[model samples]
Target: MSRTQSIQPLIASRSAAHRAARSRIVSLVLAIACLAALVFSISGGEYSITPAKVVQILFGGGEGLENTIIWQWRMPRAAAALIFGAGLAVSGAVFQSLTRNPLGSPDIIGFSTGAYTGALLALTVAGGGFALTSFGALLGGLLTALLVYLLAWRNGTAGFRLILVGIGVSAALASFNHYLVLRAELDVAMAAAVWGAGSLNGVTWAGVIPVSIVVILALLGVLIGSKSLQMLQMGDDLASALGMRVERAKLVLVVLAVLLIAAVTALAGPIAFVALVSPQLARRLVGSGSLNLIPTALTGAFLLAFGDLLAQRLFAPIQLPVGVVTVCIGGAYLVYLLNRGTQKIRS
Candidate 1:
């Protein structure tokens, strides 16, 4: 065989090997995510169920209320965490890809703040039920994102300008939420506050079903548009040069991210940081510089699932909000990232 032909075959073989390696890495990550889910599903709070028992209960081979406990109660919480994590991670990946900035997650962009505001309004002003509250959160989140987009449109969006505008909007919304909490009746405010702290403590399977349906559908939507999203990351000029509709793709991703963020926010309250950190973490784990949405989503599932477990299990009788644990850890990481970024800029 000619050297040229031989070299081409070798290159193709190496490329195939690389792809296989990445596939294996993804498989490992997903397997770990499952184990984490199983571990957390049974090992929390006063019940102290074993993973084996939990598995049996889940699959319909258990004696006693272990079945009910796992199926009705813990299952919902565990499912919520998994769905919440995956949604946030995917949303973060979407935002980061579109904005071409690491700090471009929906929470960072003030979308979550908007959702929280809507939820607060529902709870306090509207006196709405759970369904209404969920709708309100969805409305608030989508509206905030739209408003930010409008305000940030000055001829066109520069990535950094969009980020700055979003940060400003998010900060304002946070302040407004605080004011709303203070102004509401004590019981109402307390309810809102406790929920705002971010717990999966009481989420039933009913709640889980709705949130899961929404998250799964929206994730499927994002994946369907993945090619467009990848093209989007190449920047407007290049994407346009390549015959891709830059604005349309960005709009789709923005809407998808908003939907994912709103869905989880409605179900779990504003849990903070999963969306911010998970995609970055996933990328590092998978050794991909680009968005690996599936792996990132799985990584998110693991992070939130385990965090919920720790919050519920570690405290004995006192059940901390799953959100509280993530925020504490996420907060520390955020500070570290900011400080590191600042130091690099200064140096």
Candidate 2:
């Protein structure tokens, strides 16, 4: 009300605007990086094509081997990496915001493990078809989420409690997955192991199309509810005071995030740590207290695409799963994070 008080509020407003502008710039840079990674991924295989040639092929100018490699192979794999990365990152951001914990990522909190369990079960018992595997993954992830929530709920879910319960559930599910894999025939077990390692190899347009649609829809859902998510991050009492239905909003957020995680896992075989690391990296880049969904998604796309590129080229003719690369990187990051001390949920 006083002049000094009014000036202080104006200063805060200016600072907020400056931070928002910086965040937008960072997001744009990340988007460009992701695009560059996609191009590199598409053009960097054994029979290398230049970016110009890749573009030419996309524009229907190239033919024969170039056409088959770019259109039939590289494009689908690149597309899968991009979409799956974005989905996982957005899912991670939503869960982290919902739980107010840095470790609340889908991978860390049992969703990935649960999806893996489901896929393994489908492969071993249900004879391993795409539709059945996807269904199993979704069902498994959702059930694990429900179990974690129930275990963590005394009156309402707390971030630390949920994380603890999720870790336990994840451990149990990991054992279950191993058991299923061991029970399968040798060929089936080998195939399941390969899938579990999360290769982007052999992705065809048929698989990519449905995955793209699902990722797009799930991402739109996250964006639509982004405002509620932001409010929810300010603690349940404040969010309720601001006229948000905290519980309902949280439930919706959880469902959307789970759908994203489960869908990506079904498509990509529980690709490790993109969901966990991307959002954290994006937050560090933007220096934002609130979630930056677009930046997170872009960071994820870049990581996955780049990782896939490395996986393909690093061993030359002996391609590794993209998950192996990511796990190596993410595991190092996790160690660094632990050394930096645990970040607790903000009240």
Q: TM-scores of the models, in the given order?
A: 0.93, 0.95
TM-score, candidate number 1? 0.93
Would you give me the overall lDDT of model 2? 0.88
- lDDT of each residue in 69-171, candidate 2, tens digit only: 8888888999899889999989999988988987888999898899888878888999978889988989888989988988899888888888999999999
Per-residue CA lDDT of model 1 for 295-320, tens digit only, reads: 88888888888888788777767888
Q: Which stretches of candidate 1 lie over 4 Å from their true place?
A: 1-20
lDDT for 251 in candidate 2 is 87
On lDDT, the leading prediction is: 2
Report lDDT per candidate. 0.84, 0.88
* Candidate 1 whole-model C-alpha lDDT, 0 to 1: 0.84
Give the clashing pairs for model 2: none
How far does residue 303 in candidate 2 sit from its true spot (Å)? 0.9
Model 1 scores worst on lDDT over the 10 consecutive residues at: 36-45
